[model samples]
Every structure is written in structure tokens, then in C-alpha cells.
Target: MNDFSMLPPAGQNFWFIPMEEVALFRRFLKGKRVVVTNGCFDLFHVGHLTLLNEAKKLGDFLWVGINGDQSVRELKGDNRPFFPAWERAAIVGSLKGIDAVTIFTEKRATRFLSLVKPAVYVKGADYTSQSLDQEEKEVLNSCQALIKFIPLYPDRSTSSTVERIRKGSLMAEQNK
Candidate 1:
């Protein structure tokens, strides 16, 4: 078993934990309310920050389950996840509200969610309880985890950021 307790403090090496070691890590969070959220978090924008910060407020510790590179590609196509899983995990881990980060290689977070069994599971306002995958719903139900949705930032997103970058590159090329 991995000794996550021997690991560095939350900001140091706490993010980017291996999935197999997560159960061990859970031992340290016994008395704390663990909140979990999952996403690709490709470009890391204000909206993502907002969601994470709000998620933290609902519990004592926040665990972010980031989609692995392959999973992101499967869900968002080959060109998605402009930043790889490790890079994305590092970035999210550096943020203030995040406590730990784990990369999961699945289109849905059912497995990770089951393992973490967080007290609260958060999603973007774009997803309603009814819209969630049946498997995800079942996992949450089985674990008795509360499902919450944080409001999304209206004008900020990785997709929009990518579009802006593309347009800027095109404009620059035109001017040259």
C-alpha cells in the first residue's frame, strides 16, 4: 500500500496522485468532508476556477478528478485536451481551492467517484441530475453522495479560449 501520509503537503505533491493510491489517501481524510469534481479542464479558465472554488466551499477537502489524455480525446475528439493529463493535473493542483488531483482514464467518472466516495459530487450548471449518465447516477446513489451543480461562467471556457487563439493566429497570418 502507498503511504500517502508520507507525501508532501497538499500544495507540494498532493496533486497528481495515482488512482491505485487513492484508497490509501482516503484514510487521511476520514474526518473531513470530501468534495469531488471531474472534468477535462483543458485550457484552465475563469469558469473552471469558479467551479472549483465553489466546490471547495461545500466541503472540507476538494479532490479534482481530471480526465486522462486518452479519455479527453475519446470524449472531445483527437484535438481536445490541448494540455496533456499530467500538465492539466499540475495546473489544477496549483489552484487555491484544490486539495488533491487524480487522473482517471474513463469517459465518465463512475469508477473514480466510486473509489473516492466523496460526500459531495459537483458538476457544472450545464448538467442537471436528469442529464447525468445512468452509471454516474447509480454510483452517486450507491455511495449516497450529494450531487451539486455550480453555475458556469457565462463567457469563459476552454473551447472559447481555443477559438479565440485560432482566430488570433489567423489574423496574425493575414497581417503578415
Candidate 2:
């Protein structure tokens, strides 16, 4: 396990933990409900924390499936993902309440669902039972996973953060 304290003070809690090592956390989920969620998590923010914490509450273990760096680049484009997958994974893994972290390369976490077989699969409030993409819908419907949608904090997003950075830079240039 990476020593989280070795990271910079600003984001010391975020430490890259390889998903292959998740077996160590298995004891936490033994005979207990497990909840799974996946995302790019390029920018760590309050909304992300809120969602993660909430997911943890629904089950005994919270397993976060983060997109690998290559996967993030493929799904989100090269300009996307301000932070590398390792950094993002580390950050999520370091959270106090999260039980395990893993990397899944697919555009969606269907393979992860098969491996973990979580009792619940969580997404933001934007989706519904019927709104799930065909594969996701099939997975949920076929007893592959249970779907749960948490409320979305509409104003909090990575895109907005990127926009804010751009605006800040532009304003600085104007001031000069």
C-alpha cells in the first residue's frame, strides 16, 4: 500500500492504490453488502465527495471503479482528465470512507460488475431505471446489478471547474 502521507500536503489523502491490491480489503465486504460506482473523477470536488460518502452509507463496503488513464483519454478525449488516472484513483482511494478502489478500462463498468457482483450499482440522479443505456439496462435487469441513482448537484462538475480555470487565466491576462 502506498503511504498516503508521502503525498503533497495539499492532497495528502489522495494516494494511488492499484486495484489489483483490492483483495486486501475483501475482508471488509465479507458477508456484507457492497456498493459500486465508477467515474473519471478528473477533478476532486465537494460534489464528488458527497456522492462517494453517500454511496458508502448504503452498504457495508464502497468499491470505486476508476477509469484507467488510457481509458479516460479514450472516453473523455486527450484534452480531458486534468489529472492522470493514478492520481484520481489515489485521491478516491484515500478518502476516509471508501473501502476499496479498482481500475476498469471499459467505457462502462460491466466487467467490474461481473467481477465484484455488487449488490447495488450507483450513478448520479440523472439516470432512471429505464434511462440506463442498453447494456446497463440489461445488466440491471438481468440480475447483474441493482441500479441506484443519487441526487446530482447540478452546479458541481469538472467542466465547470475547467471553465473557471480558463476564466481565471483570461482575467489575469486582462489585468496585466
Candidate 3:
């Protein structure tokens, strides 16, 4: 729908959108059923895939929001966001089910959610409807969006992966 070129195709059908184009994208999606989920997505994994795939099933299109690099560092610490925001968005966008991707600087997805106003909003089962950010909840309520939670995959996480790599390196050094 956009006349200008967006970030190159991350996947067969997905679009890596520039922030300036979010309004245009949202307008383009006006009548369609949209699903949304946001996160760091700093490291890709099956857990992410499952969530995105499941989210897509709930609606006609899936729009993913990735935490900006500074936002991730603030929430996940200074050494966080192993991948830059653009790359993370591109990688997440490249996945099989994601239709669109955007990067937001806020630590919470409230602003992004408000802007997109998806028909369904999905999150990992790790969070409860009660435990969600109060402001975010208010925004969702105001927009009348359905909230769905995908069950968390027990063994899949960026933190766990990082630790595993560190432990493997230590063992290799010991063997040497």
C-alpha cells in the first residue's frame, strides 16, 4: 500500500515498517481483523514462533511490535538486546506468520497497542490479566480489544539460551 520502499522483505509476506509509516499502515488495515503482540524478540526461538503463529490464527493479520534498543536496555539491562531493534524487527517479521513489524521506544506496549487497536491482543501466559500494566490494561479496555495468552514454552527463553552458551564455553575451557 505504501508507495515508498520499506525495509526489504523480511519474509514472503511480512513488512518491516518504518515508524513514520505506522499511521499509513494502520489506516490501510482499517477494516481487517488485526492481532497484535509485542516483546523484545532479541533472540529468535520456537517460543516466539509459536506465539506469533497462534496469534495469527486468532485474526486475519498479525502485527508485531519490537522493543527499541534503548527500551530493551532500560527494561532488560545495559547488556541487553543482543540484536539491534531494526534487525530484531526484521527477523521477527521474517517469520512465517507475522504480517507486519514495528519498533516502539516505550517499555510498555500501551502506546503501540493504542495506535494499532487490534481486534485481538496476545501475550505469553507468563502474564495474567490482573498482572498486566494498569495503564496498558486501561488502554486495551478503552479500545475494546480481546486479550489472549499463549502458554509459555518451558525450555525456551533468551536468558536460558545465554546461560547455556556461557556454561558450554566454561566446560570447553576446562576440558582444554
Candidate 4:
């Protein structure tokens, strides 16, 4: 078993814990209300920051889970997750609103949600309780974790940003 408590807090490695260590890390959480959120976080954009900050307001600690590289590819296609899992975790974990970060292998967060059993689970307003995945919902129900939706910032998304960058690059090349 990993003695996460012994790990140095000053290192970026401390925050980038494996999902398996959630139970061990619970020892440090004691009485804190933890809010859980998961995403690819490939681009580290404002929308991601807004969601994380809002989620932190709901609980004492915000634990963000970044999907593994393979999982992101499975859900988002081969070109997705412009960054690797560790890189994505490092970027997301650096945010002030985020307390802990974990890398999970599943496409859905069911297992991670079950292990963390956070006080709250958050998603973008793009998802509703009715629209939530049945398996994920079941895990949340069993764990009694409240599900909240943070309204998405207008016209903000990794895909959209990528498209805009691509268009701008094309225009720049045309001018040359």
C-alpha cells in the first residue's frame, strides 16, 4: 500500500494520485466535504476552470479526476486528449480550486465515484440528472452522493477552441 501521507506536499506528484489511492487519501480528508468532478481536461480552458471553481464552492475540497489517455481516446476519438494523462492531471491539479487529482482508466467515472464517495459529484449543465449515465447514476445513488450541474460558460469548449485555432492558422498561412 502506498503511504500517500508520507509523500512531500511540495511536489506536483503528491496531487497526481492514482484512483486506487482514494481510500488511503480519505484518511487525510477526515471531516471535509469533498466535491468530485471528472473530465479529459485536454485543453485547460476557461470553461474547465469555471466548472472547477464553481464546484469548489459547493464543498471544502474539490477532487478532479482526469480520464486516462486510452479512455479519452475511446470516448473522444484518436485525436482527442491533445495532452497525455499525466500532463492533463498536472495542469488541472495546478489550479487553486483543485485539491486533489486522480487518473482513472474508465470511460465513465463509476468506479472512481464509488471509491471517492464524495459529498458531491458535479458535471456541466450539458448533463441533467435524467441524462446521466445509468451505471454512474446507480453508483452515485448507492453512495448517496449529490449530483449537481454547473452551467457551462457560453461558447466555451475544447473542440470549438481547436477549430478557431485551426482557422486562424489557416488564415495566417494564406497571407504569407
Candidate with top TM-score is: 3
The positional error of residue 150 in candidate 3, measured at the CA in angstroms, is: 0.3
Cα error of candidate 1 at position 20, Å: 0.6
- lDDT of prediction 3: 0.85
Better of 2 and 3 by lDDT: 3
What's the true lDDT of residue 58 in model 2? 89
TM per model? 0.89, 0.80, 0.90, 0.89
lDDT scores of the candidates, listed in order: 0.87, 0.75, 0.85, 0.85
Residue 40 of model 2 has an lDDT of: 92
Task: For candidate 4, give the lDDT.
Answer: 0.85
Cα lDDT tens digits for candidate 4, 69-127: 88999989999878888777777876777888998889988888888888899999989
Candidate number that wins on TM-score, 1 or 3:
3
lDDT of 2 by residue, 13-120 (tens): 432335554545554457888888889999888879988988988888788889877778887788877776666777898799887777776777666665666788
Task: Work out candidate 2's RMSD over C-alphas.
Answer: 3.9
- Cα TM-score of candidate 3: 0.90
What does candidate 4 score in Cα RMSD to the true structure?
A: 3.8
Across 16-133, the per-residue lDDT of candidate 3 in tens digits comes to 6766778778998878999999999977888888888889899988999988888999988999989888778777877778889888888898888888888899999988999888
Task: List candidate 1 stretches off by more than 4 Å.
Answer: 1-15
Q: Residue 66: error of model 1 in Å?
A: 0.9
> Which has the better lDDT: candidate 1, or candidate 3?
1
